[model samples]
Target chain A: MSPLQTTWHHIRRSPFQSLIATTAMFLSFFFISTFIIINSGLSTVLKYFETKPEITLFLKDGLDTATVENLQKDLSSYQGIKEITFISKEKALTIYKEQNKNNPLLTEMVTASILPASFEITVSEPEVLEKIYQNYSTKTNVIDEIIYQKDIITSLLNWTNATRQVGFAIILIIASISFLTMITIIGMKITNRKDEIKISRLLGASSFYVKKPFLLEGIIYGLFGSIFGFLFSFLLALIFQKSINSFFQPITFIDLNVNFYLILLFAEIITGTLLGFIASWIGAKRYIKF
Target chain B: MKIVFDQVDKKFGIVYALKDISFEIDQGEFVFLIGNSGAGKSTLLKLILNQLKPTSGKILLGDIDLSNGNKDDVNNTRRKIGVVFQDYQLISDKTIEENIALILDIVNYPKEKIQSRIDKVIKEVNLGTRRFLFPSQLAGGELQRASLARALAIEPEVILADEPTGNLDPENSWNLVKLLKDINKENNTTIIMTTHNNEIVESMGKRVIKINDGEIVKDYNISKKS
Candidate 1:
């Protein structure tokens, strides 16, 4: 019989053992893939927020066009400033009217003279946001008020970092457990077939010949585990895509395409297979005597 | 291929499992290794199989020195010899045919010839009808025969039957012995059978090497004596 055929025979003979091994691997890979998806989504949301206008500097009520133009030029010359847009009072009033278009009373009440003109500044990095805010906050002569979502951005960053650290710890713990479970399962199988191994050796079988089936068996378990794990995560993502998108409104947080998922699946499969190979190698080496 | 043991001594810690054992069996020779329990017959077989390295002296299978050979050399030596154990060590999960096929597969036998070869050996052991049966489904005698068929599947230069009939009834034992003799005559395959059964030994009139306390007590040909 071929090594594959032998492995299949062994799995068939011990379905419960195979299932236990596959299940352990499945749980580990499931958590790993879920963590990846969630972390990716969080990163997407953070990126969307980071790229938005970081600081909005509202000007003094009677600032002239030249004064606003000078402010725009000054902001443009600042380091880490990606873009600086001068929103005139008329433009601000137009935005207000558009935002409240459903309510005629709200739109009719807004006028260009009442609306404050502002400079909407986009920074290249989150680190630069606080610096710009500090520099403009003291300029009350030309600036009426400075608005920047520094606290929200800081909190979002902290949450993403925490999720990554905790997710990584969980994956490491579960992966180690999964690896040990595989070794124990394969070791038990070897122990049960101790006599058969001895007989095969006595019959002139090589060590490779005796070990190949076990390694293949481990690979099979890992392959199935990773494939099923990927499928489960994919299905969950599909089911919750709309909710997740709405939760992070306008961000398109979970917009992964089929190609991206295929790549992730491939990576998970490789990891799972490598884990199985190493675990089985250790198990076979530890137990089987030539 | 011939097997030669030149003053081989196997020591496990302070005790000697075999001491200063020397013998040579020519190609195609049929020899009975007669010894009582704990007489080191198993140790001698292990030495020939290269399962245990000799503490001192040498063992040679053909030109390969088993005493100091590497793993590849040991495997190469083992490939030339087929072993049948007293327990009829057939894999319990596999059928008789699969058990035979497994050995053939291990030897890297021609893939196309494997099925035909398995059939020939199963037929030789008179297990053609029971080839599809697992070891658990077979009787003791049939299990031993399946083991024999597996041994034959390798087409080995030497066949080592280590107390193969130990668990069988007298009739089964005689039948297995007769089968071994016929195989020996037909293929001219070197046969080394270890047994404590004096009746089989006396009836066969073959060469006998009697071991006692890890030493060779007697070596003679019964046919010549008669």
Candidate 2:
């Protein structure tokens, strides 16, 4: 038989042991990869929030058209500014009317003249929004109240960081359990083949030659298990894709990236191979006497 | 071409199994190791095979020192000496032909040569009809014949049979001894076996070496007349 076929024969002979060991490795690495992928996406989303525009400025009543135009030009070249948008008082009044139409009590109080012309201002970054607020809080007739949603920015960062920490901790715990489980399965296989190993040694086979089949078995277990785990995790990501899209609407949730998935695939195969090789090596080494 | 033990001492843990034992068997010699249980008969055989290192003293197969040789050299030496055990040691799951083929497989004989050699040895052992049967399916005599076929398949210069017929009935045992004698006569292969049976020993008409209390008590050449 070919070496690979021989390896499969041994693995096929003991299905239950192989399954349990492979499953442990699969779950450990799968959860770790999934947590990393999702948390990294969340971290990117948090970063995007921190860089988004925060404040808008409303011009004073009865301002000339040129003065409003001049304000846009002035803010465009100003320091600590990311972007500026000029909105006419009529457009502001229209937006105000449309928004408040559902609330009749507020619609009666709102009018075109009452609503001032405005320039929407976004600072260099969310962190600098407060700096911009401090810089222009007293600037004469340049702005009405400076408005930015700092609560959302702060909360996003805090949540992403917390989840990343928990993800890391869980990955570590699962890896340890999988390591122990794979090693145990290897030990059992060695015990079962105790006589065969002794006979091989007596036949003048080297320790390594005798250990080949067991080590190969472990590698195969890891490979098939990881591929299976990767498929399951991908399906899970797909099932949640729509909810993720709706919840983070303006900021699209990225599906698994092609490059990142390739890397994870390589990781799964290597992890499986190493786990099998190491566990079987350790187990076979103990029993395959020279 | 011959095995020689020069004042070998073998100890297992705190007990001395064989003490100051020395003997020589010439090339193509047919001999039997006769001793009671625990008389160091098996220990001497293991020493000659280099399976157990001598506690003190030397073992030589021809001119090569077994104790000082490296693993590769020991394996090369082993390839020249075919060994059979009392238990048959035939892997129960493998068929007779597969069991014989295993030795060539381990030694990495070319595939084409392995099949023909297995077929030749199977026929020589008169096990051609039972070649495809697994060890568990075969009777004790057939299993023993399979083991002999495996040992003979390698075509070694020396054949060491450790109680090859120990577990067999009289008819089967006699048949096995005759096969060994035939192989020795036809191929000039050195044959060494250990047995306690006096009737088989007397009928063989070969050299006999007896041991007692870890020492050689007797060594003699036997003839058919007496």
lDDT of 1 by residue, A1-290 (tens): 88899889889878999999999999999998899999889988888777767888999999787888888887777788788888889999988887667579988867899989998888777677787788888999999998886677789999999999999999999989999999999999999888889888877778888999999999988999999988898889999999988777667778868888999999999988988888888899989975
Please list the residue runs of candidate 1 whose C-alpha ends up more than 4 Å from where it truly belongs after superposition.
A59-82, A89-116, A123-145, B224-226
Local distance difference test, per candidate? 0.88, 0.79
Give the per-residue lDDT digits (tens) of candidate 2, residues A1-290. Answer: 44566567667778899889889878976886688668767976887776655676656677677877876776666577777777787788787777556568978877777777777777765556676567567765766766665777778778887888888899889877877777778778777767666655565556666678888887877777778777777777778877886677555565667887788878887877787678767766665665
Question: With candidate 1 superimposed using the best TM-score fit, by how many Å does residue B118's alpha carbon deviate from the native?
Answer: 1.7
**Model 2 C-alpha lDDT per residue in residues B1-226, reported as the tens digit of each score:** 8888889888889789888888888888899999998998888888877889999988889888997878877777777777888887776655788767767766667888998999899998899889999888888888888888988998878888999888999999999999999989998899999998889999889999999988888999888545
For model 1, the local distance difference test gives 0.88
- Output the number of the TM-score-best candidate: 1
Q: How well docked is model 2, in DockQ terms? A: 0.40
The prediction achieving the highest DockQ against the true structure is 1
Give lDDT for model 2: 0.79
